[model samples]
Target: MIHHAGLIAAFMDGGWRGALIQGPSGAGKSDLALRCLDSGFALVADDRVELWTSGGRLYGRAPETLAGRIEVRGIDVLPAPALAWARVSLCVRAGTPERIPEPAFTDDFGLRLPLLTLALLESSAPAKLSRALRHLGERR
Candidate 1:
């Protein structure tokens, strides 16, 4: 397993795919993830995610002790709907998002996933992520 310093959340439309949210401490990784979960995505891991590659695809899972738990800032750690694992399709970096971000990708266990950069505190962050995933799906 590959240890990661970020949050992993999954969304299922016809199938499941995850987004690896990475950034510095207090960069709103968990906040954006919670927004995604609120928008119907499932939690794979929070704060720390364990990644692995299988059949050329990268997948993410929560460490045993952290499964089904998410720490909301200023609130106690809360139990949330979670997935044991998910195939990751994207990596969202929590930073300054461009009006049209230059194409980017992130590597996990030798597998590459599309990267979308965004400012997590923006009110439209969740909607923007959803849109990006949908656009990615159309290209697949």
Candidate 2:
């Protein structure tokens, strides 16, 4: 299925795991993604993501037309380094995040992805996501 989401992949354990960013327009999804990229994550898809299920896990990628491209709100659509696809490990919803929220999950293709709410524009958002991914890795 195609979704209005942005996908960014973080390198971990010699592989890439995607974080699916979802929110309404102007919710800073792309902005968050750019920050993630600047922080060493790879772009999978920006603005729209194609999702599928395989081996009990959800995976995401960019559509052919949008591959290797990301839209920067104030700037032109720019080319970026991207992966063909990635196993999704997390879902981030742009919003007013709780200071210490309960654990949450979001279902996609019957697979539940660990969920985190973040104020995407905050300078610390990318670091928070990196920490969350590390915590999730520790738990597994």
Position 34, candidate 1: lDDT: 84
For candidate 2, write residues 25-94 as lDDT tens digits.
Answer: 9999999999999999999999999999988888899999999999999889999999999988888889
Candidate 1 per-residue lDDT, tens place, 16-121, comes to 7777787888888888888878887778899888887888888788899999999899998899878898877878888887777678776645866788888987
How many pairs of residues collide in each model? 0, 0
* Best candidate (score: lDDT): 2
The 0-to-1 C-alpha lDDT of every candidate, in the order given, reads: 0.78, 0.89
Candidate 2's TM-score reads 0.95
| Candidate 2: segments with Cα more than 4 A from true spot | 137-140
TM-score per candidate, chains pooled: 0.89, 0.95
